[model samples]
Target chain A: MKAVTYQGKKKVEVKEVGDAKLIKRDDMLVRVTSTAICGSDLHIYHGLIPGMYDDYVIGHEPMGIVEETGPDVTRVKKGDRVIIPFNVACGECFFCTNQMESQCDNANDAKDTGGYFGYSETYGGYMGGQAELLRVPFGNFVPFKVPEDAEVEDEKILFLSDILPTAYWGVDNAGVKPGDTVIILGCGPVGLLTQ
Target chain B: MDYRLEHAKRTNHVETYNFEKTHDIDQTLLEATKGGADVVIDCVGLDAKRTAMEKVETALMLQGGSLGAFNTAANVVRKFGTIQVIGVYGLKYNMFPFGHLFERNVQVKMGQAPVIHYMPELFRQIQTGKIDPTDIITHRLHISDAPRAYEIFDNKDESCIKVVLKP
Candidate 1:
């Protein structure tokens, strides 16, 4: 399958790579229908992120059909339309249970930080979804089920994987209320979404 | 081009300006907001514009990426105001403004977004048409164009705000 791999500073390439395969019992393989280049991805593209070597797959925002699921997957199954959140979280962990899945204790073995897809090894060495297919873990939690209705387009919901939620979280984090004067520093994707 | 600032105004109906264009963003924001804004959100993170010294420090590994936005946040936020950071920052900084933030009793919150937690509500908002994330997408290219896509996005060429890649 062809996936976008990091070449070096300000460089990326579409290269044929190994097909994604389900390895863990709760893993799911998604045939990516749509994926996006995030502002954070540019950090890696600029060679700022450590642990990213040449050919490291690099993307996070993705949504598509669940082509296959591992034996133990239950929350979603084959053929389910889902948006994979960047965070690789186990739902039962303390942080996950407390609504802080981004800091899930079990996702990343390399560092204390939670696991994220396609990021450098600091987050997790998981391959990103900027390809034909992606291997998603913690199937019971990570794959967010999109509405089964056919009306929703992939474009409408893909940002839910990151920017939309990140924007909302930013507003909520600052306790901004209606009529309050809030100054947003960056007019990038996440910043614009926050507005 | 000021495409990004214009897009924010036209699409989101927010008053926006380019900080780089202003002589002093701190003074401009302070005067405009009557001393300071109630809240300041630093979404630019480590990728913000760098001064010459910052470039040297960052290149030497003595500091993380530019703290320009964060420092601006510290200066332009009202006393006891809140500063929320949504942008990604790495490692440590040479001169983090802990003393100023502490003196002002400012509150700060930052981290990875914990995206899964807000999925349900945001999805509902999309379903109901209260928000449209797709509005930001200015380019749609095939996966094979990954190199050009990254270049355009990083350079903000072609007024590119966002790019979606299909395989």
Candidate 2:
């Protein structure tokens, strides 16, 4: 399979990598149809993210079709088009129970600091979706079904994997009122989304 | 309104503070607001050139009125006006004119934006045509050209607001 790998600072390459498959009962294999490069990925590209290793698959935002799923995965099935959340979390953890699945205790325990796919060392070192296929863990918790009549494009839906949620979070965090004037610092994707 | 100059231009009420050719930030702001602005939001986040912590210290050293975002916010705002700081600064810092805040009764708000909580609402806004996130995407390139996209975005190339790479 081919995947975009981060080599070092300001470096990335599309290279051949081993195939991915279902690794857990709750895991699902997705044949990636669309993927996006996120600003967070630039942190790795610029080597600002410490502990970044070589051959790291680089991407998190993706919308794809389920190629296969483990027996325990029930939220989506083969042939279902879906959007993959950036994070891979166990639904049974305290954070997951509270709807803060991004900080799931069980998933965090598995990695140094758990995060979604394609993040650097600070987050969990899960491979990302800028590849031919992706192995999505806890598929039931992360894969969202695409609306039947939705006219949203893959690029737009792909943003739901991280930036869209992040931008929305920023506006909410700022407590922006209906008529309040909000000024975002960075005009990057996340910042622009706030506008 | 550094990177937001273009977007702010779309809004009739938005006044920009360009530091590139102007040294009189206070005066520039005053002219923009026509005496003073009701609210001042700092998006520069401790950027040395824009934040100018040293300049603020110099003003304090000379016993000058408040300067920089904090002091400017205090001075240029109407009494009891609001100052929302979206910029990042040193946690263990000092040298701010804390007394003026009380004198003017200014309100200061600052913090990191928690982006997850607002996803549902933002999504609805996009769906409803209230805002177009795509407008910010000034550059679109192939996934193979991702390196160039970063170069343009980082360097702030002309009219390059956001770069989207198709993979």
> What TM-score goes with each of the models?
0.98, 0.72
Compute the DockQ of candidate 1: 0.89
lDDT (Cα, tens digit) per residue for candidate 1, span B8-103:
999999887788788987999899999998999999999888999999999988888899999999999999999999998869998899999999
Over B72-139, each residue of candidate 2 has an lDDT whose tens digit, in order, gives 55566656666666544433335576887778787776653332333455556667776555656577
Model 2 DockQ vs. reference: 0.23
Q: After superposition, how far is residue B45 of candidate 1 from its true place, in Å?
A: 0.4
Question: What DockQ does each candidate score versus the true complex, computed on alpha carbons?
Answer: 0.89, 0.23
Worst 10 residues of 2 chain A by lDDT: A180-189
* Distance from true location, Cα of B114 in model 2, Å: 6.9
> Clashes per prediction?
0, 8
A128-190 in candidate 1: lDDT tens per residue? 989999999999999899878748898999999999999999999899988778999999999
